[model samples]
Target: MDYLSRTKRQYWIVLFVCFLIYNALIVGLWLLLHSLGSHFHVANDIALLICSVFGLLLMIVFSSIISKYLIEPLKAIWQLILHISPSGVAVPAPNIDSLKTGRELVANLAMQVYQLTAVAGQYGTKAADSELNNNFVANKLPLPLFILDSGETIIYANIAASDYIGTPVKDLTGKNFYMVMDMSFPSESTLDKWLKDVKANTATASMSWERVRLNVLDNHPTRLFDLAAFYNKDNPQNYETMLVLFDHTKQYSQDDQAVSFVALSVHELRTPLTLLRGYIEAFEEELGNEMNPDLKDFMQKMGATAQQLNAFVNNILNVARVDNDQLQLSLHEEKWDSIVESAITNIALRAKVRGIKLESHIEPGLPTVGVDRLSIYEVLNNLIDNAIKYSNDSKVIKIDAHLTHEGMIETTVQDFGVGISPNIMSNLFTKFYRDHRNRSQIGGTGLGLYLSKAIVSAHGGNIWVRSTLGQGSIFGFTLKPYTMLAEEIKNSDNKDIVRGAHGWIKNHSLYRR
Candidate 1:
């Protein structure tokens, strides 16, 4: 039998034995009283009544002693044991002073047992408290965090995650991660492949999704989130995975709206600027020889200013297109010399106005490149223009092109200018970022380099700048060389087949020319 049940049975047996002894003492006293009454000639009724009263008084006294010395102390000890049980309650220590010596020994033994049990349970209580603290911290965090078991089952989710998923925390537990997320990918196997790559440690365990709908309910807004997964090393054989999510929905929306507004406003301003430039060019063309030299120069300056404004507008439009993923390119095989000449000719007027000499060095027999000709021309123009603006007292600007050992064409535009500082260089190509030191000294919309970087990246290349603060700066980019394969395709008579085979060769081009 269990300890509680055996103890209860023993208690009942003790009570029964006490009852029998009390009754035997009462019966013996009554018999003796009756015999004394008969010897002393007293009434039998009076003797019986007296014996009954004495028996009742004796029972009451014995009951009070048992309850005070035994029952009450035992009850308190039993309550203390229950309090220290796994149920996590607290009870006051029992008072053993009211008990007689032998009963007090039993009470002390019970108290010792309670103390030992409390010591044994201390570690478990601490562990429980630690877990409670961890959960509290996780739930209080702003970002959503989830803990998954070895089977990719979500064992725990923070309050933010539960709110994001539109489910209660208890309901979310035991759900599979993929089912809870309900991710959509380009192809059916894309998610599987990504998971496999993450598990195999062949790819980064972080990913982002645009316009991800967290809830299955209709009309739910989509959000962008950066999700990262990491293995929990606490258990080696059955490790857990921690998933964290950061929301970027509001930021992306604000950026999109800002870019659209700038693009629209700049597009509207371009029309009047174009008309002003046309009028200036017409006036110069009609009265150039007959007009005074100063007047001619004034007209020329007006034209240059107009052209600069138009270029800034174009940069703004290009930035918007790139941000919206609407920049389309018409790629073709073009000779490096022809592309370079066109870019130089376009920027020659600006370079001459700044008194900065333009120089070029092209390695002989440099292979033709597959690129969007006009886009590359814009890149070169922006770099040279930037060089001319920053060249405080320097006069020489060099443009060099050569074939790299990796079979790619590398082009560099070096200028003897007030070079960029290390702090500004890193953020030079970020959209809408202006160098605080040069913003007042030089006039620019800060989108030129950003557009250049975007154009180069679209051509499957990279662009970077190197500079020493007082010396000079060099801007360089690499492009894939046009191969015999491109030549064969260009020479082929099957135009329809070429159009069908290549997706990048679409004719509905929207990019700046």
Candidate 2:
């Protein structure tokens, strides 16, 4: 197995054979000279001296020839082995055909060694890859797996695959996949199309799928998987498809149970909220004629609580609508600044009642964003509402809007009231996530910020928050600007519908809307 042990043994055998021949020839010459030269002593002595010198010179010449032809090539091979990296492999230099002798056998042997070295290097790489893949399949994977080649042949299957196939993988391999497994592969599906496209353009694609299945071990539970396949993204060869699967039967049952629970709970809560609002309205109406001032104030507070409950129910409905894709945007181009001013006016009375100051810092030349005027107004209203609710008396809530370099209008609502903790920042945009670490004294359904973030994102923009506890918070969002096409313009009369009131710049509208 070791280079020196094997090569040195070969060199010793060759040297031994050469030594035997040299000894035999020397003995034969000595015997012949001893028998023929006894009669001519002087002449034989001179001839014997010449023969000894000639034999010595000849031994030196033969040794040099052997080193050049046999020993040197082996030494070069040994050097090549030493140069190999930890992987036990190297890319051999091009075959030195110039070193080859005219002898046919020598030339043939040299060519074979060159070819074998090339093959050996490739084998080393494949061996490493095979070991890694086997480890990954046995330890890392939680589900059964198989990789298919372009011809739909099973190229690699893991231990899970063997367990799922109800037989050892070796038995299933080389068997036409469709013949062994009674399943249908759609010819018109994305998988087939991807294969064709890859062949045509030599580009990779991820395949879409609805379902897949596998046979578990005999007497074991059979498995059905929802699956998707993608071309091997990392490899340039793209010779295989990576199949991902999930147990859909379990997931489907869980979804069914969740739906039933939500349906029952929503029904139960709706009845109580409806009754509370009805009673509050009746009490408020009765309070209009009440003589007790304390009772009247209590009734007014009850009315406000009832109104908050109503808003909570409305938020739930809106979220449900969005989840079901039933929420429609009545998009129109409207004055950007005018919408902000209108929202400010609408909330001015509420802000004053709460003893909070509302202010705007609009950029001098901010462009309009495409949005449903009412939806954008709702987003601003929630931020301002929360600011006023959490702030102490005389705290200022500043709303700023400006045009960004990428043509988006960036709007931020800054509140220098109680800030949020970093741990809770991630959950702020999630539905019904209340930051109860502080500001527990304030009231909300916790849906306001969540709904506002969703609405802004749905408009092809992003919303984010920056905050440090005990410092302040900045709730910011970006929106793409809306531009009216030349053909959309009619007379100023028609333009009034798109433009906001009081010379307000048109904010946003969709092209097709």
Candidate 3:
């Protein structure tokens, strides 16, 4: 039967038993009183009156007990259920253990329900508090962040994002994401297409686009943002996209100024250095026979110093050009043998001074390469000069060239020196990167390898290095073998020949032995 029906039956049975017991006690008292009255020759009305008064008092006491133990506790439990809230359940102290069997069962059931509700309420409170804390932290972040819903609505935005758009976050929400931020692309169709793609690819955990332009609606300056969008794994269909913006304008401007300064300074310095070299050469030519041997040697040293300065200046200029994206190559068909021979001859004096032996092995019948002769010469000169400087006790450098399986000419500059460690090898060709271990021992601007890599890449080639820590190092680069089609293209009347994309060169895979 239901709890209510069972409780009603128990109540009826308890009342019936109480009635019977009260009647039995009253009857016994009457009987005893009657006998005492008879024995003492007292009035029967007095005995009967006393018994009735006592019976009424007994009924009152039993009713009070039932009200306190059963009625009050059950009423409080019912009130608690009715007033339940996330905060907690409200109920008076319960004496469920002292109650009769039927009332105690009802009381226990009510307590269990209250306990479950209290536990659930506690969990709900904790979850709400955690969400509030997360929101607080997100709003305090320095970078602008936005939470956009699936319909491209601005459901949430942080304080930085608000300041960026010159509006309060409250005003920003409930508005179309693109409308509030005023993000634009090179073309409207491009923006539409990108948005479509992002929405369609919901399976992607996170997506990012760098260097996106943000056009503020409140007349604030437009800025570049590295935007990232992510989904809530639990509720992907309804989750918001997290867009973060990282500013890089100041960094770009600083880099631009630095490159311009280097380019200008190098140009200004080259003219005077050229004049000094010319004068030194002229002096040596005029007074060679009359001057003492020691003086002639000094003049020749001055000449060599001037030449080294000129080369250093050239390197700085070229590096600046690369940074400014002004590097251009004049492609022409050049015999690889003659190019290598010329580079070796130019560095012969330096090699002799350093007591380093230079060796070259060119494959017979090697095809000519399409390249800018001057740029390739610079690459060879830089590699050989580095090899000489790091030759250590083993003063040997070798240059080898042969046709690769890909039909490209691969040239390697090998040096028996303190080979590069694994940690430093990865960053060897990065601009302005110098090995801390060798920086004190070697004098270099750290731009030679970087520039060489850039020039080689411009010719649609790849460059890499392989080295053992203490054994030796081999730096290699590939060049496209000259073909009739490439020759014809080079011979075309077009003076502006652009080969590769103008940007940083990614490291090619290291050529394994």
Candidate 4:
């Protein structure tokens, strides 16, 4: 930094000296003009005007000369700047001998530049040697390693990476890391998401994650591994974003199987939940006209709680199915109002329990949508349940359904709650991601939005969120109208399923596919 300041100071000093000389010349011209005015008996006003014009022309010409001889020469002092002469740029031959002192200053500045270049060259050599040594060690390591750019595009991959990915490094290079590695993690923060966060937040940092599932792009066997990511370091050009993986499949597979067994055991809780729901339904039926407002609210709360728990159990099972490729959506024609009403009914009680009102409005005459009723029901359940949980002091949650101009049913659930922060919005729908601030205060498994996103996407629809801090959030999703889906099926290849889809984005989610 100081080098730039010193070069700049020398540059200005040259300009200042030339300026002083130019001023003296101007003063000499004024005196010469006064002498002519007196000797030729010309008007003093005319003499002054003539001097002013001459002075302007001289100033312009002088500026051109100084810029060419001095400015461009001095610019070489800082070679790192582009669009200008670099360190090796040739200074004009036959130095400006008329300005001997200026010529010497230029020589001094050039000598300093040469010294700077030599020092930089020595440093570059050392950095190169260090990087070569690091690369040698890295290639010998058992961990699968990859270097990616800011967009997660793989630039280099080691031999272990090729073995792990089931492809040669040459073939994997230049592909998007995410596309090449068809994998997922059970953790809140993923390796890719953490890479982005680190790039934005820090200069030098690394993180390690365990139990990262690695499913190679090709039809290769999936494996579990521990992962590490490094982003934006003061290293060689290609080492900016690097990732390493340690195989842990054999170790984690048994643990995963154990968890699955425990989950199957927990599934038995549904028997008690079924009987509990039956008792609540009996209460609702028997109470008849004798129940007061408070008793009605109590019954509603109990019923909603039981239903909510049932949904969670199903969600866990369905998520497992999704991971195993067993989850499938069988879309059928259903009235928009029918789907909204069923979902709202299930979640309305939960809202009432939290003292929050659900205001639902479906536009009249909207076309029926093509969606799997059970799957979409869960999507709505997750969304509205989230709204109820986060609607801090707000009392009302609005559910709006309308036929978009593009012939899709757009459903939105809005809440005036302590909304999400902008910094954390990108990973809101990713698996197991909960805002740390609310993670302790709130009771959740961090899977609701992720499950909701997966269900909606599997239905060939798009889901997204829009929120402002303290102003609350709006979670919206769009489903194709049954008529349109039928028409498209009749006209085109079935492969082009999702057309003109606004999959998701920052605030608008307006991207089309």
Candidate 5:
């Protein structure tokens, strides 16, 4: 039996028995008085009858009045006991003077009960207010909090709980927790068994749980959070589970930014160093026979050191740009034939300067390709420049442009320069991943290819290299088929006109997105 329910039943039974005893006493006193009146014959028969009737009526009226006053307060007490909400209700107590002589003690007892009830109500109100304030503060706290009863039903949750589940607090309550995205718990039997074991094993036992991934918001990829459950130290009847989110997305983004910055910066530095290296080599060649032979060797070594430094700077800068997502590709509509011609024309001087011949073949009437003009220009420059740098003197470097059946515009840069090694091909797009096979002769920052790939990707294109260690390399990328922005706007307007029945689904997508 429930303790509080059993206590209430006992109270009511005791009150009923007291009422019966008091009524019985009143009836017994009346009967005794009547018997005395009949036997003593204090007056004639008619007088006796009148006096007895009067006495009986008076006694009945007084008993009824006393019973009414006393029962009213007792009934109020019973109601107060039954009410769960702690609203103030004054117990209608009896005035001691209004009670019959024999009922004065009962009235006094009733007044004392009323006073005790008032004091209890005051304390209860203070405690409830304190608890409410604590709950308000707890709701705003960062930690995910939940309260559950022995039946495993969620009773309360804080604001962090709403965030963790990706819903408002009101909507979350009464819903089965496991139904929410990415939250899980042990089976009921398993949890109960574990609790039993923990209670049996030691003074205290705790185990760290694994991290759980949950997509707390729509369209976002899953993120990790640490979850833990423990026994409530102050209340053994309850258990609490807490969750903490450790955001690692920003950490990864920062690392990428650092790499991209290093790549771009190094590439920028190399351009100046390359110019310096060329001057140094030219001076050394002119002064070679006139200066001491040993001095000539020292100058050659210094020039070589400068060349290597320039290459190192370029590779770091290119890789950094890729990682940081800072590689910008300015997209625009441009004729494929014209863009190809301009790209080749710009790099033609560099190829000629390097004693490498330049060749170009562009398919006529190829539809305009939407691409970042500046980024594509750099891509062409880097590929052609690298070809000239590594090619045997006066070797040919070819550039080609065409359209694919899949509505893609493709561009390729073919170079006969000492080709990329199979082992180093995968690392070519990586920052500062130099091909050490040509380490003895070639010099570059190794960032050009990395940056080129990153730029191509930003323009919604793909880039790859085809090569063998000693043959040549072909670097190519494919851009998406171009469509005018005007056409896109036209399609959007048509979608608006096709509303009504289909509008509902379209509206959902628009709002959801």
Candidate 6:
């Protein structure tokens, strides 16, 4: 039998025997009292009173026995364990030697209990110190790191994290992560959105973002870095989320600022470019009758070249504006068809120069669109210009506008060009992005498509592409109707409507001159 069961059975047997003996003693006293009462002719009430007093005295003796044997030992053991210390400084051992009976048992038990407590306390202290040291090292490390609890609040941030974020440790702790970081990405997919998606749908996940820009609201310059996220759904370490940052601001901004400076310089060159174009047009008009055939062709070429330079300058400035987040949209209700016609007229000279014909189609009675005219014009120009640059021995570049069943204005620029590879689609709209293989042969600053995407997105539209190698490519976009987009903004929960699943599905494009 088990130890507890055997001990429990023994206890019952001892209690039953004691109960019988005590009852027998009571019977004996009652018989003795009755005999005395009869022999001495004592009153029945006096005999009963003597019996009651004896019963009360027996209870007091039983209580004294319990206190000395059971209660006293238990109290001494508790105090023994309490006074024992890991440092080996001992207190008086409860004076168990005074118990007189089983003094050896109580002393031995106290010694055993004290030994167990001393051992446990030492190991516990060591483990606690190790954990404390680990935390101290993490806080002092120069690498930026932080931990987040299940609530997405910042539970802990290292010193480096506080320095990188320009916030103090006390200020950062307990704050929601999304509130502190004003983040933007080259793609619509962000760190926070990915975190939510992983939490709801997966057991564990890891995600990283490259060239993640951290926009600072104060005097500090914006920071650029690569961010990595680590997560576990069931973690023993307690924290559910951890993020580490690798600051690459110096390297990334060095290249970007240098390019932005040169691009901004193009803003100054525009006036001279306009004068140059004006003079070229004047020469063509004044000398039209006197010039020979080859000379007239040369004049036409000069004007076309000037127009090309103007387009390049505009692209440079637009790209800089998009990078700096300075591009603002002034959307007006306008005729979608008229916009298309104007685009064709403006880009016709470039198409003629490239030996490519411009073609256009518009579904009749199309609704007006909410758009920024000049930026929309640039979007069209960039798309068609890209088609023209890559139109490998192709003839016609077709642009069409039609109202879709979804009540959005849809447009596509189709070209029989050296079709885009299945790869490189995701990065087509990234700023400063270029396909290295075509760098030598293709001439462009790679800003056209990126600038186009930013503008199209600002207007609450979507851009996408479909391509097959060695055949042709079609770049398409959609614009919500003016009334519908305005209504969406007014009714939007946060007063902003962002493209979620659809916007990130397509790549950005650029102009190649």
Q: Top lDDT: which candidate number?
A: 6
Worst 10 residues of 6 by lDDT: 504-513
Q: What is the TM-score of each candidate against the true structure?
A: 0.46, 0.39, 0.45, 0.44, 0.39, 0.45
Q: What is the C-alpha lDDT profile of model 6 across 165-281, one tens digit per residue?
A: 899988987899878777888799888788889999997898899999998987998899999999887754446788999999999999788776866688578778879888988
Extract clashing residue pairs from model 1.
Answer: none
Q: What overall lDDT goes with each candidate model?
A: 0.72, 0.63, 0.74, 0.74, 0.59, 0.76
Clashing residue pairs in candidate 4, if any? none
Per-residue error for 362 in candidate 4, Å, reads 1.1
Better of 2 and 3 by TM-score: 3
Which residue runs does candidate 3 get wrong by more than 4 Å? 1-260, 289-298, 484-513
What TM-score does candidate 5 get on C-alpha atoms?
0.39
Ranking by lDDT: 6, 4, 3, 1, 2, 5
As a TM-score, model 1 comes out at 0.46
Please estimate how well model 5 matches the true structure, expressed as its whole-model Cα lDDT. Answer: 0.59
Q: What shift in Å separates residue 452 of candidate 5 from its native position after superposition?
A: 3.2
Expressed as tens digits, the lDDT of each residue in 95-158 for candidate 4 is 3234323445544555454445435543553234233333434455578988887667887787
Off by over 4 Å in 1: 1-263, 484-513
Error of 5 at 484 (Å): 10
**lDDT, candidate 5, 1-513, per-residue tens:** 353354455545655665676567656656665777689864456555665676577667666755664465455445434332345564443343443232333344444544454355435432342332244345555776665444445555667777765678777555654454444332243334554665556444444333444545566655554455554433333333222334444554565466656656666786778788788778877887798967866676566456445434544544555565556443445566766666666556455545567889988888776665556666776787777767755379888988877778888988876787787778988766687866678767677877888878876789988996567889898887667333533343323221211122332323111
In model 4, what lDDT does residue 253 have? Answer: 95
Could you tally the backbone clashes for each prediction? 0, 4, 0, 0, 17, 4
